[model samples]
Target chain A: SQQGEEDPQALSIQEGENATMNCSYKTSINNLQWYRQNSGRGLVHLILIRSNEREKHSGRLRVTLDTSKKSSSLLITASRAADTASYFCASTLNYGGSQGNLIFGKGTKLSVKP
Target chain B: GAGVSQSPSNKVTEKGKDVELRCDPISGHTALYWYRQSLGQGLEFLIYFQGNSAPDKSGLPSDRFSAERTGGSVSTLTIQRTQQEDSAVYLCASSLGPSGVGTQYFGPGTRLTVL
Candidate 1:
């Protein structure tokens, strides 16, 4: 499968603590994106990091891409109780002639306690 | 100013029945996509439509699943002879241009239960 796999299927942390999730993919990708889903509802785009970019930050979120290792990580600093959600890493790879069809990871379920 | 919207937020149907899910993408957005999310699972790509070009239906699981975009705006996904395994949340997303570099805005999704 071309889908990526996220480490630590579940993580629990206290409020104000930082949560880090790792993702490893099997193929070369154009970009990797992080998304947060509350319960089973729709997903909210968190951040995107291109292959050429080493790292990017958005607010309290940080994303890093290591193309040589085919791995990526998402770090959420000062996580709050509201940050509890299922986080997924999606990658876009060029297969045949199609581009940008996102293949998602199984996701990491994070719970932040207040 | 509005986001993607889906109808019949929840539906319960008997097996072997046909069902249709609707999605209204953000106005002016040219790229639309459909996905399925099973419980505790990742998003499964279903199909994609880019303006008037042919849709990429490579991710469709079977012939019983099909979708169509109307006037390059709204889209509908129809499932024929639905099976119990077909139960899932049908999600729709749209972006300003090509999804290769754009962020996709998703709808709340339509929850289908095949009993």
Candidate 2:
């Protein structure tokens, strides 16, 4: 079952603009993480935000998590053509046997035009 | 440090023929996971293994799918009587341990094509 769903299935933006993607999950979680996948490549971990953390910053990336809303958002500042890729949100359940599994969202396809 | 590695990056096989895909997680990593992504779809969890524990096979779609991890290092996913619907990119990942909060490193993936 999918634990997270990302808004804006596809987004096209011009270079240097900021791009934001939103993700909503179905259950309570311990952490929310973002990953990026280039064309025909495996996913790369971008950033992670704990349930208690309202927001976090990693270089040009920012992630915000809201346990109450069961939602999270990823922001890419000064988007570049190199940022063109699929972004996925994965949520880890708060407790129980499913704790070790990372349920992934369908992802948002972002295109940054140079 | 070497990252996760998957074997036979691409495989094309006939329906009803069985196929096995392999994954080698990073050294010292104790948690490994398998997932499959169909065209234009997000990843679907297949199974996961944590050091010395029975694998969690609840996510497997059908009885035809089975996986095993040996010595808690390399793992293999086997699909019996392959069908067209089984075509997808099978990905493998590993983290430091059983904690989901740890970062997962993924392999390039095995693109299985069933004809």
Candidate 3:
């Protein structure tokens, strides 16, 4: 299973606070991506970090990949109430089998209180 | 055009009924995929299609499940004599290429409720 496992299945935080989510995977990957899903909606791509790249940033989203530990972390700084949504980390493998199918984690549901 | 689109957004069926779910991928995308997610569970890989080649159906759980891509643009996933365990959200995704390592755009999934 190339599935990335995300910890802290659920989180609640005050608006404007920083939120951190961690993901762990079993196999080597070509790149790792973070996505956000509004309730009952399609997934929105957040950020992607490649194997050689240790960290990446897009807007307020920061993604850090540690291949040595086979883990990655997503940090949302100055999160707002609109940032409340489920977040998932997915990875593309070095091996090819599931064509364009991203192995997604169970996801972490976040609730930001205004 | 627009992003990936899926039809029959919600489906409710009885046991032993056959169901077909359709997916219309982004225009010009060459890769399409199917996945099933049970309540609170992670996404489960079902099948993958790349251009006109044979699909990689290794993730399909049983022979009862099958899918096909027509014209490399649209796809239909057919489940035969479905069982109660088949209840889940069926998601479809499409990518610009056969690079499974690339980011994909997902469609709003069809939620299956098997009674």
Candidate 4:
């Protein structure tokens, strides 16, 4: 079963606009990671925010995790057509053992119109 | 450095036939994983391997699905008696270790089609 669920199943915006996607999970997680898929093939690692960390930034990407709400959001500033792809949020359960594999969300398809 | 690689970018087979998919993880990486993605669906974990420890096969959907890793470098996922529902993108990934917080590198994935 999918532990996380991305919001706004789909999003569309013009180039240069910032795009934000949200993901909510039902269980306690050790960490939450974001990934991007282009052409529906390979997935690229975007960013990861550990449970103890609240926010992280890399290049033009900003991710915020609200453990209290059991949700996380990905923000892409100055979006470009190249950013057009599917974004997914995956979480690793906080079971008191080996971290194990990740549980992924359905993903949010973002379209950046040039 | 070379990233994870999978064989036969695409495969087409008839139902009831068996098929094998291969994954070669990055050199020196000790963790490997397999996942299945159906059209418009989230990725589902199929199996995981960490070093010499027994692989976690809890995610495998059936007895027909089996996987093995050799010499801690290459892994193969085999499906016995494939079904139409088995048609999906099979993805492979590898990381430095099994830490949940580590980033996993993914391959281009194999598009499996069952007729």
Candidate 5:
């Protein structure tokens, strides 16, 4: 079963604008990772934020985790048309085992219009 | 240095037949995973194997789905009695370990279309 769900099932944004997608999980987690899928292809690793950490940044990607609220958000600053893709948040069971192959959410589809 | 690879890229089979999808994880990676993605759908976990042994088969949706990894390198997902609903993109991923923080590199995926 998937443990997380993303809001705004689909979104349309203009190029160079900021895009924010939110994810809420049903359980605690050791860490949360974000992934991007282009068209109907495979996934690309974007960023991962650990529970011990509140925020993480990589290139144009920014991830914030609010463990207190059991939610996380991914922000793509200065988005490009290439950033148009389906974004997913994944996490483990968060209780006993290691964070293995994640349980993924339905994902948020962002379409960046040039 | 190579990422995960899955083949034959795409497959179209009639219902009630059998099909096999293969995945070759990055060399030396000890963890392999198989996920199914239906059209406009989230990834559904199918199986997980570590070091050529699967400790979790609970993710498989049905008994018709089975997978195996040999030498902790290449893994194959075999679907018996393929159904129309089984038509989807089968994705494979691998990582060095289940260590809560490593990245799982994914393959291009095999798009299966059942007729």
Candidate 6:
């Protein structure tokens, strides 16, 4: 059961353009985090937004969370070829007592053409 | 300062054979997790270990899949009677605390191929 479902299964844009990816999940969540994977290997943590927080920013990455809608979005500004990779959104349930496994979305394949 | 590490970057075994994969988490981290990713698919949660407490094995696909974390630092995932469908990338991650409270660092992952 995938908790987070990312929209726009794939996207393509120019290097200087901006790319936006959206994730929608069911049920309440404690927090939502985004990760980036290159070459289908290890994933790198990008940013995380807690249920109490509405928005957060790290470098060129901006993340927003809307509990009411159970959705989150990731915006990458000035996209570069280096940013071309698969992006995934994961969410942790709000349950108690150490049940902290993350349910991940299928991911969005972003292609930044230079 | 070292990140999570997994052994045998890649593994290839015949069907019905048993295989073992290892994960060495960062020093002092208390939480470890295992995930499986098929081709062009999202990761599937396998298991989780937090300190000395019992592991959360609810996500394991079958009885053939089992894992253990020794001394709260190193862990191993074992698969008995491997099937072709079991071939996928096995990723290990560790965090300072539970995923709800901390970010998890991932390993390079082992590419397992069951022929």
Interface RMSD of each: 1.4, 1.4, 1.8, 1.6, 1.9, 1.5
Better of 3 and 5 by DockQ: 3
Model 5, B71-110: lDDT tens digits are 7789999999999999999999998866445778899999
User: Ten-residue segment with the worst summed lDDT in candidate 3 chain B?
Assistant: B50-59
lDDT of 6 by residue, A1-114 (tens): 789999899999999999999999998898899999999899899998999999999999999999999999999999999999999999889877547878899999999999
Q: What is the TM-score of chain A in candidate 1?
A: 0.96
TM-score of 5: 0.95
For model 1 the local lDDT of residue B31 reads 89
Worst 10 residues of 2 chain A by lDDT: A93-102
Candidate 4: residue B33 lDDT (0-100): 85
Worst 10-residue stretch by lDDT in candidate 3 chain A?
Answer: A92-101
Predicted model with the maximum DockQ: 4
Give the true-contact fraction for every prediction, in order: 0.65, 0.69, 0.73, 0.88, 0.67, 0.69
Minimum summed lDDT over a 10-residue window in model 5 chain B is located at B96-105
In model 2, pairs of residues that clash are none
lDDT score for residue A89 of model 2: 97
Task: State TM-scores per candidate.
Answer: 0.95, 0.96, 0.94, 0.97, 0.95, 0.97
- What digit string (tens of lDDT, one per residue) describes model 3 on residues B1-115? 6999997899999999999999999999898888887775668778888875545677898999999998989899999999999998898988887867667888988989889
Mind giving the per-residue lDDT tens digits that candidate 6 earns over B1-115? 8999999799999999999999999999898989989975669988888875545677889999989988888999999999999999999998898655788889999999999
For the second chain, the TM-scores of the candidates in order are 0.94, 0.95, 0.94, 0.94, 0.95, 0.94
| Tens digits of per-residue lDDT for model 2, B1-115 | 9999999899999999999999999999999989899975669878888874545677899999999889989999999999999999999999996868688889999999999
In model 2, state the lDDT of residue B68.
89
* Model 4 lDDT tens row, A1-114: 789999989999999999999999999999999999998799999998999999999999999999999999999999999999999999889886644688999999999999
Question: lDDT of candidate 5?
Answer: 0.88
Interface RMSD, Å, model 4: 1.6
Q: Report the C-alpha lDDT of model 4 over B1-115, residue by residue, as the tens digit.
A: 9999999899999999999999999998898889999975569998888874544677898999999999999999999999999999999988886766588889999999999
Question: Cα RMSDs of all predictions?
Answer: 1.4, 1.3, 1.5, 1.2, 1.5, 1.2
Ranking by lDDT: 4, 6, 2, 1, 5, 3
Q: What does the lDDT read for residue A33 in candidate 6?
A: 94
DockQ of each: 0.67, 0.71, 0.70, 0.76, 0.64, 0.69
- Runs off by more than 4 Å, candidate 3: A96-100
